[model samples]
Target: MNPAREAMINGWKSPRKGDRGRERERDITAPRHDSSSRISKPARQQPPAKSTASNAVGKYLTQDQQSEQFVADEDKFVLKQAKKKADIRVREQRAKPIDYLAFSLRFIDTDRDVFDDHEGDVEVDIPAPETVLESLNHAQLQELHEDLTSYQTLESNARNKEFWSALLVLCADRRQKLKPQGPEGRALASVASDVDNILSPKSLEQLEALEKQIRTKLQSNEPIDTDYWEELLKSLLMYKAKAKLRKVCEAIKAAKVELLRLVDPEKAEELEESDGLPANSHNFAPSPAKPATRPVASSSDAQSSAAPPPGTARFSSTGNEDFSQATKALYDREVARGVGEGEEIFAAEEAVPSATKPLWADKYRPRKPRYFNRVQMGYEWNKYNQTHYDHDNPPPKVVQGYRFNIFYPDLIDKTKAPTFKIIREHGRRRGESFAPAGKEDTCLIRFVAGPPYEDIAFRIVDREWDYSAKKERGFKSSFDKGILQLHFQFKKIYYRK
Candidate 1:
């Protein structure tokens, strides 16, 4: 055996029983040719070596000796020139701005038959330098991952001669060079304990054959098979997808924890956990163990937990509660616990901003006002006390001069449960005047119609206290500016003319 082969043999015994048989088969099939046969014969000549003392004497060789040395040097020079030319060609090929067709074929076609199809108007736009470098780095990482995975699988199935032989040869030829870098390299270091168990002469032989074939193809300018490359690309994509899913689940768990923290700071403090999403599974260390579930609260406990202290603002069970107030209170509770601004909380690094340019007013960019007021009303003029004699305190019916200019018609219909509040406060008047406590009915409209569609449907509740009990009020109407007005009050409505 050669020195390299002997060293490999000394490292470990064969991992497969069929190693000898495969070796014999490979040797029998290997190509053999006469070594003495030459395609082109050149005239044999000997050249004199220049003596060290000849430098002091200036020149020592005669014309005949010089010609012989030139002939010998010419052969060496041609060989060196050919090698230099090959090197230059490789560099030029690599420097040629990315060949889109070739790149597409690298992923799409294994035999690379599509390389010839690159002559069309298919020009690959040169990406920004950073983008190109990033992609190249990713490709290198992917290549390392694939090689390591293959090596690992082969090592595991060492009992199978086909795998053992292939792996052994790969390990022998590639050894230090095949070792991965980055995250994959770290993983490889961890799992490379059974290298001795997987190496054998047969495996080495198989790897050698494959390596030779690849080198031959590259030298001959032949393309690799499409099916092989397609399967490889698919495997890479699947790995990436699985890693992405894992990351997404980890992020969701982290977001849930943050939300829980915002809801109850004391509970968040009790938990005392880290507050960030997991690192990407593709390149990071394995994930930590799942967090434990929080203790569940009993119904009574939850009720006690939600109840406010005595003397604070309280909603009576009998009184009609405002839905908007309830919604706002719930939202505020969430925000206080840990909820961040929506866009900042969810935005990811990889997302690219949209390129579509907007109008000058909106450029760079300007935002429209989100709040506005339509009408003003006096607080005291809007309030009236409910009489004990009346069964229900009816709302005032408005006499609108227009029908089409309604507000929130779709959301404020008869089906809606509207709540009205009467604010009571005492205000100081000018000198010599005493301010009396006054109340105003400000109806809270929960459902509002969006812009461009103008219509407001309102509920005229007869019994504010008995809101759950429905009463059908008769129609009342009034005519003004060619529009008829309808009013309903305390189970009675009038049609005005």
Candidate 2:
């Protein structure tokens, strides 16, 4: 036989046909190595299952005991899998406890570890009183005027009464530290509730009567006869004080749909009409148009009287407690010259000499300031001024003085005619300054010099930072703490050697 045939007869497998031939040849050439007397090892058996349930998704069937009739169809398989999963989930869910009363109870007895304890002294984040005062100044009023002009066109674009109502309600609310208790404590809640009740089907007649009565009383400036409701009606009327009663009218009309649903339809209609006064009523009429005709005045027929001429400026030394008359006269002159209402006149007025220094500048002057000598950049220094210790003759204690020593690119001229310029504090260990030259934006630094650096400490008075603009003053010092006992100022120098 061939070597390959002989290898096959020996009951040994070959890797390939060529390898088989080589293996057969080697087997034939070499001694016979094996006899077929070895027994095969048996396969290992799996552990017995605890239950008959198979934890897999399919028709349950045994390896040899499968009956085609017992096999589950696709739908049955899916249904069985879903039930098994659902049962497992239910068992897991039941393992955990559910606190049924937790959600229903208003208060809990659990440990109060979530909230922080109240400290004896707590700081509030309200705006400073000084900032509030600034907001009420002329600067804020000017800003409001600009805003009014910019947003006036969109005023009538939407009929969103809710926005106005919500704002009014918020303004009426005053509590700052805690949430409102309920409808009684919350003004918004009360208003919303009242609105809801008024829109109900049964209250329509009462709403109509209320509106009619309110309208009549408003026209006559008489109070409504209703007990407490009269005050509520009055408040509503006052809310429309700046409007043509149109806002009130519109609110009442909107309430009609709800009122009719709650009350009688006839009553709802009456309230609607009352909310909006009739066309003939004075409460609803649009303002009359101004006349277009211009008045003519004769040139020579109007001979000049003893009255002051136009553009004539007047200065008075008599300190009147009330300058109303003088102010009105000035305003009239401007108006006659075509200056619109309350508009500022930039034109220079006729020059009139003052008899005395202005009271506004000296009315609240400090006694006397202490003086100091220091040239600094961004450091804070504090010392006492001589004014605080002087019981007898008081010399004007001024701020620290520095001589103009070096001429930098941004030096400001202090003599004769001076121009505003940038300043940098050179000697301070900490701090930086960059000033630009401009009429409106330049800073006016006051410099003073009197004593040695050890004599007094310089302080800042009425200095403020504009956090919104991320800008701060360059020089910030204190006079021996908060007391302004010393005067300190900055000065330029021609040379620093």
Winning candidate number (TM-score): 1
Candidate 2 lDDT at 291 equals: 11
Model 1: weakest 10-residue lDDT segment is 290-299
lDDT of 2 by residue, 1-497 (tens): 76656557876543376676456446465655456656658988988755535643245545644554344344344332332322221221110000111110101212212221112101101121112222232433343234333222222223322223322332222212134367444645456457445433333345456668666766784555453455555444333321322343354345434435454666555645563422231111111121110001111112222222232222111111111333223322322333222222222212122223333334332111111122223212222323244435443433232212111111122222211222223332223333344211222233222111011111222122322321221333332221222122343223323
- Candidate 2: stretches off by over 4 Å: 1-154, 157-209, 212-236, 239-418, 426-497
Model 1 misplaced regions, further than 4 Å: 1-225, 264-439, 443-497
State the TM-score for model 1. 0.17
* lDDT, residue 479, candidate 1: 30
* Candidate 2: residue 39 lDDT (0-100): 62
Question: In model 1, what lDDT does residue 199 have?
Answer: 25
TM-score of each: 0.17, 0.15
Model 2 has a clash total of 39
lDDT of each: 0.29, 0.29
lDDT by residue (tens digit), candidate 1, 132-173? 222333333344345434433423222222322332333332
